[model samples]
Target: MTLAARAPVPGRFRRPRALRSERRTLHSWLMLPVEAVARLMTITWNPVDAFFEAVFWRDAKRPGKPFHGGWNSMAGRLARAVVPRTRNGAHVVMQVTGHHLRLAYVSSARTLTGAPGAVELGWYTDLRDVTWIRDRSDVVGGNHEIGFVDGSWCSVHFVGDGWSRMPDAFPLRLSHLDAIPTAR
Candidate 1:
């Protein structure tokens, strides 16, 4: 047969079998590492929600109490990620979920009693994308308060609840902070 008149074969270019095998191998290797990391970094909104509900809102089994400046008990809860300062006292930027509400409370400094710690307790509400925070006690007064909780914006302060009485120092910045291991 002359080269110019030769017919082309229809099935010669197809390779469907090789594509599936390559895809399967790639998926198997990627999945192993993905699974381990997923388990380590998994954060459930349920634990955070339940803790806030039990402490602030005070469900039926637990009655709410009254405090000084505003709300007497916890009413709601939301998720928060805290980034602590390094050993050299350098403040790290934390990815707080709310607006510019990413405030820090360092406790390593000594207080009036000559102690080397501080405690911070507050009630916060997450509405859509905005977050409202209210101190549980008067430990932090003027500098932290906004105004009265009327039509104007302000954070509530509690008077006498146990949570309202946070120590002047705390070891960790946030109670819910946990470390997820990284793979080598």
Candidate 2:
């Protein structure tokens, strides 16, 4: 067969275009950082582990604590809202920062929960610290940038106003795509 019409014949060896397409698309995007991380021996942001250590472990230390329960309740609501109406599910990653906490899910289609889902609550702590909570757009690191694998789904949510009020002044963002290196 000619080059243009060439195919991977059953008994013979030929490179598949689908394989090339996969490499050029999602696989490449995901692996670029993996390769860089493997070579450089560094991690820019470990959101998954960071969140578990920062939030989950703290909650386990104090069962039914108001803050813990509130976050869990909000997370569950966000998950139910963003997850697609299919057999597949999503992974939700929530981030807490000085200004506001943010959540983003990686999914096959865009899932956005705007103002209607926004809820604010206030309370006073025994430590005399006042608390203000709400869904805020402010986020840091790769907390907002979600990745999707073909038909996979993902999402995120911010539960508190955090330690600050002004949103524009916060310096947080998703990992830059250009900063990553390629893998073999």
The lDDT for every candidate, in the order shown, is 0.28, 0.29
Candidate 1: where are CA atoms >4 Å away?
1-59, 64-99, 111-128, 131-184
Q: Compose the digit string of candidate 2's lDDT tens values, residues 63-134.
A: 321111121233222323332221122233344345444434332222244212212121111211112222
What is the TM-score of candidate 1?
0.18
- How many collisions between residues are there in candidate 1? 13
Clashes of each: 13, 14
The stretch of ten residues in a row with the least summed lDDT in candidate 2 is: 1-10
Best by the lDDT measure:
2
**Residue-wise lDDT of candidate 1 within 26-121, one digit each (tens)?**
344566687688977765468988788768765454222221122222211111112222221211121234322333333433445775434332
